[model samples]
Target: MPIAVYVLGLGIFTQGTSEFMLSGLLPDIAHDLGVSIPDAGLLISAFAIGMVVGAPLLAGATLNWPRRTALAALQSVFIAAHVVGALAPGYGVLFVTRVVSALAYAGFWGVAVAAAVVLVPAEAKAKAVAVVASGLTLATIIGVPAGTLLSQSSGWRTAFWGVAALTLVSLLCSLFAIPGGKVSTDETHTVCAELRAMARPQLWLSYAVTAFAFGAVIVTFSYLATLLTDVTDLSEGWVPALLALFGAGGLIGMAIGGKVAAAYPIRTLVLGAGTLVVASGLLALTAESTAATVVLVFVLGLAGYVTNPVLQSRVFALAPGAPTLVGATNTSAFNVGNALAPALGGMVISAGFGYASVAWVGAALGAVAVPGALWAGHLQYRGPRTGGVVAQGAASQEDPAAARARA
Candidate 1:
């Protein structure tokens, strides 16, 4: 497992860059392909749509496959996708390339998360999950920035080439590193049974909680460059640095979330959501000041990412029956929220409210999420205390117990 996590993380990091680097490359992509910025934006939407639609459907279809096989196959498809994107003849072909590349996000990341849990002893599940999940954070921290620079220096298409190369490395690593084991939950339950897990009201509740929290972050960050240069009045070079700072905070948050969550995941869930609400307000107001803006942006990233590990941990506690599907669907919810936030934030920005307005939109939506967190809290109180008990058992071991609780 030493290299397995790194392998999986690298694979996911490549996928993450392919999926998210578009925002940074949008202008170049638009102008190069003879399309409008809005048209280029659709590429982002297409990738996200692929993820939201693909996670469960792909999981169900590949339900019986071994974990390593499934992951390798998905990443191979992603590599082909980036290659196609690099060599695309026109917008249609490139768009399809994006959709194809995006297909890897949900299934691979989901399987990877489940794999991380199973790869270690029962005590390290949360830590393992965090390590795997860091791929997305690292994409933001390292991949996106590096990809942005690559796009600027060579061309946006070159970034795809880079990601494709990374995927090849990941493929080799997956071949060597992943130990044979069960990654899919559908072996015990039918795909129908797994799909039925979504029918439970708690699943929808989990979706809402995740949807809003992540949505809040994306809405503002989607237009973050606009905010920094236009609103915050920072120079162009400062944008990536600021974005990286946010990612750094996310790195810290992801780690802290795992550590603190063992004691009271339920409380952490609400606290994490609430932090978004307050942080959004602070960011919206302070965005005009360079110093305050930078500090708040870092804090925002920290608080925003803290919810991810906590939310994943909560979903596992609630839906132990199908943790793989649960984890997969939760990832879908994150993108669903991502798909939503910017569109809504766009309407405000379009109305001439200014760049910082997106932050307020994020704030309002985040405020709405707090109540959902509270409702989840009540559900925890009334319903299964099993997760709480397990979390308590986990608390004693912290990371050690996390690895044990994978079952």
Candidate 2:
């Protein structure tokens, strides 16, 4: 609950707006750059690729720098990337810019969550992370819709320019607000040490849970507008409003999830994923009714994000020694889900299944995480005996209070 936590959230909002707003601008970008809509859609994939590559790599590469310094530097690069994107002349240039921006964005996210964790008490770590992540929910609520409106009225380039300006503001806020100093020597480690921390089976299971659980959310969200128009009989003008409703549900879910994740991480994961499975199944069955579609979309968003804090906190807890790298890897896992789920959803839609089929895909992905979460919980209860010798050593070195908090 520190002021710095809110500032970090503000910074995340700027970066997230840049990331999510592009989905709304794809049509305008495709027409303006003389490309097909599918081609323009590749920009999303390019960003995800950059995130998966950049998160762990950049976090390890910058392991020696102060967290505050790393965050400021990454935000500067992000702002510059958006400026370039705003001025891009063709599809190739825009695509390259999106990748570059995403690299900086991913690096920022990797460091930012670790930084947030350090700023709060062990008991408040999940809540702090939730505060930072709420920025993304807010982006879906306010930023993406506003950007889409701007693109509709002025030009797609204008949305990019607006993001650049907002990022500059966030950059200034970070410079002034975040405390200055390197991470404690005890928390810092060599590249090999960090790599060793990642060798835990439990850690990988946590990542798997993150990937599939969140992927379920994206499967339906990636084509929500299409679903509304094609099946629910909604007008195009209502898409943004409906998306905002989903974001509202996300905000509510994150608030509730943060409150419970610290004490019941695995239970929260199972319940959250279970909620997604049920919500998605209902959505698939009732997509034709406008009332049902609206209700289910909100429920889907709520259930999908309820696990965010739990997934993030679990990863950090699993690798207590390598917070930065572990946090980055977890971010990468979420993006991996983001990248793969949409492709799967697209395939289902193209195979002659209706838009509602995406919900079934989501349900299956969510279902996969249930057992994964249970297995992780079983591992946690059993201690680190089977988690790999290096990871066990790392966990044994953690503070007793911290370990108890995690339990």
- Give the number of the best model, judged by TM-score: 2
lDDT of 2 by residue, 1-407 (tens): 99888988998898888777765676678789998544665677678778888898888777777878988899889888888889998888888888898889898888788788889987677678888888988987888878878887899999999999998888888888888765434554777887887787788888999999988887787777667777888876777787788878888888888777766677788999999999999999999898998898889878888888778777776677787789889989998887787778767777779878989999999999999987776666554344422212344544444433443
Per-residue alpha-carbon lDDT of model 1 for 298-386, expressed as tens digits?
Answer: 88788888877877766765566676777788888888877767677667766778778888988887887788877765544432333
CA lDDT of each candidate? 0.76, 0.80
Cand. 2 Cα-lDDT: 0.80
TM-score of each: 0.89, 0.90
Off by over 4 Å in 2: 34-37, 352-354, 383-407
Best by lDDT: 2
lDDT score, candidate 2, position 142: 88
Give the C-alpha miss distance for residue 365 in model 2, angstroms: 1.6
Report the lDDT of model 1 for residue 41: 64
